[model samples]
Target chain A: MNALNRKKEETFKPLGSKSLLSRMAKYRFLYLILAPALILVLVFCYLPMFGLVIAFQDYDIIGGITASEFVGFDNFVKIFTMPKFTKAIINTVKYSSVQLFLGLPFPIMLALLFNELRMIRFKRIVQTISYLPYFLSWISVVGMFSAFFALDGTYNTFMATIVGESYEAKNILTDAENFLGILFWTNIWKNIGWNSIIFLAAITGIDPTLYEAAMVDGCNRFKQVLYITIPCLLPTIAIIFIMNTASLVTLNFEQVFGFQNIYIQEETEVINTLVYRQGILNAEYSLSTAFGMFQGAVSFALVCITNFIVKRVSGVGIW
Target chain B: MKKSFGEKLFDVFLIVFMVLMCVIMIYPYLNQLAISLNDGTDTMLGGITVFPRKWTWSNYDTIFSNESLIRSTVVTVITVICSTILTLIVCVGAAYAIKKKDLPFRNAIIWILLLPSYISAGVIPTFILFRYLHLMNNILVYILPSAFTFYNVIIIRTFLSSLPVALEEAAYIEGANEMQILYKVILPLCKPVLATVALWTMVASWNDWTTTLYYVNEPSLFKLQYIIQQIIKQSEVVQKMVNDSALTGGSTSVRARPTSESVKAAAIIFSTLPIICTYPFLQKYFVKGVAIGAVKD
Candidate 1:
C-alpha cells in the first residue's frame, strides 16, 4: 500500500503543484490586458494625489511647499473669512439647484417626446440637431448668446419691434446681479440634449408589451408616459439627482469663467473660478488650499448623505 | 370609455407643437450657417437674413490665413492624441484589473478611484496641487488629472467582463501564456467598446478649455478652443468699434465691415467640423457609450 501511494503522489506532483506562481502564470494574459491603464493611473492620478500634501503648507514656486510656512488650519481660517468665498458658496448652491431643476427634467422630457415621434426621420433629425449643440464650445455659445442679447442684437431687435420703443441695452455682462440666473439657463440649453441620451436608453429598455397593454386599456399617449415612462426612469433620475447634488458646489468653470466680468463678480463667481483667481492668479497658496479642502469636505458630505438616502429609499446605493 | 374629440385635438396639437419645437431647434444652426457663408457686408446688417446677400468663402479664408489658428490646431491635435492614448491605457488597466470576480481588493480599489469623480476635490486644491508640482505652465496640464475618467473604466470593465471567458480558457489550454491569450483573444474582441470610449475621450479633450486656463499660460500651448475663444473676444471688440464707426460715418473699414459676423460664424463651424463630420459614422458607438453615466459620474 505504501509503495502504491508513493508512486501515485509522485505522478500527481509534477502536474498539480508546479507552484502557485506558475498557476497565476496560466492567467498571465489577463494581467497584460490591464497593464497600460494601471501604469497611467499610477503616474497621473496617483502621482498628483501625493501632491495634495501641499494643502498643508503655504505652497509657492520660489520657496517650494516644504520651506514655505505651515500655519496649520490658518489657511482654512482665512478661506472662511474671505467675502468672495461666501458669495461663491451661495452662488454655487443656487446655480446647482437651478441646474437640477431646469437641466435635469429637460433631457428626460426630450427623450420621452422623441420616443413618441411617429416619424423616424423627424426623430433622427431632431435628435441630431439637439445633440449638435452639446459639441459647441461654451465660449462660442456664450459669444452667440451675447450677440443675441446685445441692445442692437437679435433679442432686443425683436423686443423693440414688438414693444414700439427703443431700449438701450444695459451691460448685462458687467451687471453683478443677473449673471447667475443666465449662467443656469445657458447651462440647460447646452447640456439637456446630451444628457437625454441616458434617459432615452432607459426609455428604450421599457417593455413594449406594457405599452401595448396600457393602450388596449384605453390609456392615451400622455397617460402611458406618466405611468409607464417616468416610473421606469425613476432609477436613472434618482441616480443623476444624487450625483448632481453631490457635486453641487463644483460649477462648470469654463462656462462661468468665460461669461464672468469683474463688475459681475458677485453673481458670476463659482468656487472653481474662485480657486483659479485666488490660487493661480493671486498665489495665496495657503488660503486656496484651505478653501479647496473645505469644498472637498462639503461635496463629500453631500455624496454620503445622498448615498444613505438612496440606500434607504430605493435600495440602489453605490456602496 | 370611448375617445373624446377634445382629446384628439389635444393630441394633434401636441404633435404640431413638437414639430414646431424641432423647427426652432434647427433654425438657429441654419441661420449661423447662412451668416458664415455670406459675404461680410450682409451679415453686419445683423437683421435676420435667411440667405447671404453675397456669398463668399472669405470668412473661412481668414481663419486659414492666421498662424495662430494653425498653431492652435497643432496644440489641440497633440493634446487629443496623447490624452487618448493615456486615457485608454489607464482605463483599460484599471478596468481589466477590477474585472476578475475573485480578485482581492478589487471592489475597494474601484471605490477609491470612483469617489474622486463623484465628490470632486474642487478647483482650488487641484490648482494648488498643480502649482506645487511646478506643472502650472506645463502641457501636462491637459493630460494628467483627466487621463483616468472613472466612468470610462467602469463601462469598459462591464463590457469586458461580459465577454465569453471560454475563449480565454481555450487559449490557455492550447499552452499560450497570458500575454498571448490577451493579445490574440480579448483585445480583438474589445474593439466595439474601445472605439466607443475612444470617441468620447477625444471629444472631451477637443472641447476642453478650462484645463488650458489653469495649467497653461503659454500661447504656443493653447488648445484650439482657447485660441478660438481668443478670436471670438477679439472679433467682439473689433466688431463693436466697426458698429460704432458705421453709425457715425455710414461706413466702416472694408475688412471689418464684411468680416466680423461672417467670420465669427465661420469660426464656429470650423471648431465643430471635426466632430460633426466624424460623429455620424460612429453614432452607433455612442448609444453604448452612454453606459458611462449608467455606472456613475
Candidate 2:
C-alpha cells in the first residue's frame, strides 16, 4: 500500500519550472475554495490571539491597543490583588475536580451497566430518554431547575410528602451550602449520557469471541466485565482523560452563568464569570485580559503535562 | 447465554433502576409541562405534579401574543437556517481543500484552525474585536462568527480522506474539472456526513443565546433562548417577592402574578418543544455522528 501510494505521488509531481507554474495555478483554485474559511479564522481567531498583548497594557476604549500605555505586569498585579480572583480560582478548581474525579466515573459505570442489559429494545429506549437533556440549552435546564426548586415549587411539595410537613424548604438555588452539590449533580445529569456514548462505542468494538471464551471459563457477568471489557476500554479512557485534563482551567460558561444569582454569587462565581464581570460589566479590560491569559497559560501547561503522562502510560498522545 | 437465579435477579434490579433513572431524567420537563398548562394562580399553591389540575392555555396565549417573543422566534429560525448554510459552506470548502494531499501549508493551516479549541482570547478582546467589526447588536453576529467550526471541518476532512481515491481519479480521467468533480462526484458521496454536520449545527444555532447575551442589546435581535432567559429571570424576581412577603407574614396581601410561574414554564416549553419533537428522528444519526466525529480522531 505504501509503495503504491508513493508511485501515485510520483506520477503527479511536476518537474520543470513551466510545469511548476501550471501546478501552482491548479492548486490556487483549491486555495480559492478555502479562502472564505481561512479569512474568517484569521479575522476572528488568530487576530484576537494577537490581541492578547493588551493584557500587558492599560487598555482604554478611546485610545485602543495602539495608544494604550503598556504597563509591564501591572495588569497582572491588579488581578492578583483583586478579592474575587482567589475565590474564582478556588471555585473553578473545586467544580472541575468534582466533575473530573467524582463525575467522570458515572458515565463509564452507566455504559457498563447498560451493556449488561439483556433487553435490547429497553436499552435503546433508556438511551433515548437519557440523552434528551444533552440537547436542551443550559438556559432551559436552569429555567426548569429554578422553577422546580422554587420556594413553593414542586420539589418542596414532593419533599413535604416524603420527609413530612416538618421539613423546611430552603430554596436550593440560593442556599450556599447546596451550590457545590447543584454544580456537581447538574453537571453529571447534563453530561453523563453524552459522555457514555464513547464508552458504549468502545464496548461495541470489543470482540464477542473474547466474551464467549470468558463465559466458558466460568466467568460470571461481573468477572467478564472486569477481565475483558475494562481492559478493552483503557485506550479510549486514556485519550478522553488526557483531553479533559488539558481543559481543566475552563468550565462551561453558560452552565455557570445560567444558574448564577446574587444570593449564590459567593459560592457560584468562577474565573470565566470574573473575566466577564471585569471586562464587559466593570470595563476593566486589561486586568480581565490578564486573567484570561493566565487561564490560557495554565491550561496549556496542563495539556503538555497530561500529554506527556498519557504518552508514557499508553504510548498514544493527543498531538 | 443462560442466566442463573442470581443473574436473573440482578437483571430485574437493573431494569427497575433504569426505569427510575429515565423517570428522574424526564420529571423536570414533565413538571414544567404541567405548570405551563395549569392556571397561573393555581400553580402558586403548589402540588401541581405531573398533570394540570385546572387546565388553561392562558400561559401559552400570553407567550404567543408577546411581541418580543414572536420577533425573537423569527430571529431564531432565521439565524439557524442562515448559520447552518454558512457553516456548511465554510466547513465543506475548507475540508475539501485540506483533503488534497498536495495542498501547501496544510498542516500549518490545520493547526492554526484548531488553536481556538485550545486557547481563547476570552470575552474581552473578542468582544472588542466584534465591536470594532460593528457586529454588536447586528444580526450578522449570529451568522458570521460560527462559520469556521474547526471540529466539523476535521470530521469532514477525515471522512473525505478515508474514501476511495480511485473514484475522484476516474472523474479526472473523464475530463471533469476540479469544481465539477467536487460538486458532482465527491459531494454526492458525502451526504451522510454533511447531514450529520448540518443537524449538529442546527441544534447548536437554535440553542445559542450567549451571542445575544454578550453582543446584542437591541430588542429586535433578541433570540428565543434569550427571551426565555429573561422570562425566567422575571419569574425569579416574583419568587423573591413572594419569599420576602412570606418572611414578613404578609401572605394574605400578596398573590401570584399572572406572569410568575405559568408564563415562565410556557416559555421554557416553547424553547424546548421544537428540539424535543425533532430529536427522535435525529437520534439515529446523532449517536453515530458523534461517535464517528469524536472517536475517529
Top candidate, metric lDDT: 2
lDDT of 1 by residue, A191-296 (tens): 7667888888888888999999999997887899999989999988887777777658777777887787556765567787787788778877566656776777
Q: Write the per-residue lDDT of candidate 1 for residues B202-283, one digit (tens) a residue.
A: 9999999877777788878888888767756676743553354455543323543445766677777788789878876777
Question: TM-score for all predictions?
Answer: 0.87, 0.93
| Model 2 chain B lowest lDDT segment of ten | B250-259
Question: What is the alpha-carbon lDDT for the whole of candidate 2?
Answer: 0.85
* Poorly placed runs, candidate 2 (over 4 Å): A1-21, B236-257
Candidate 1 displacement at residue A144 in angstroms: 2.3
DockQ values of all predictions: 0.40, 0.66
State the lDDT of candidate 2 residue by residue for B1-297, as single tens digits: 677999889899999989999998999999999998888788888888889988777666666656678899999999999999999999999999988876767778878788888877777889989988999999999999888898889888888987899999999999999999999999999998898889899999999998998889999999999988887766664454334435545333233334468778988999999999999888977786777776555
TM-score of chain B of 1: 0.85
Residue A218's C-alpha lDDT in candidate 2? Answer: 92
lDDT (C-alpha) at residue B44 in model 2? 81
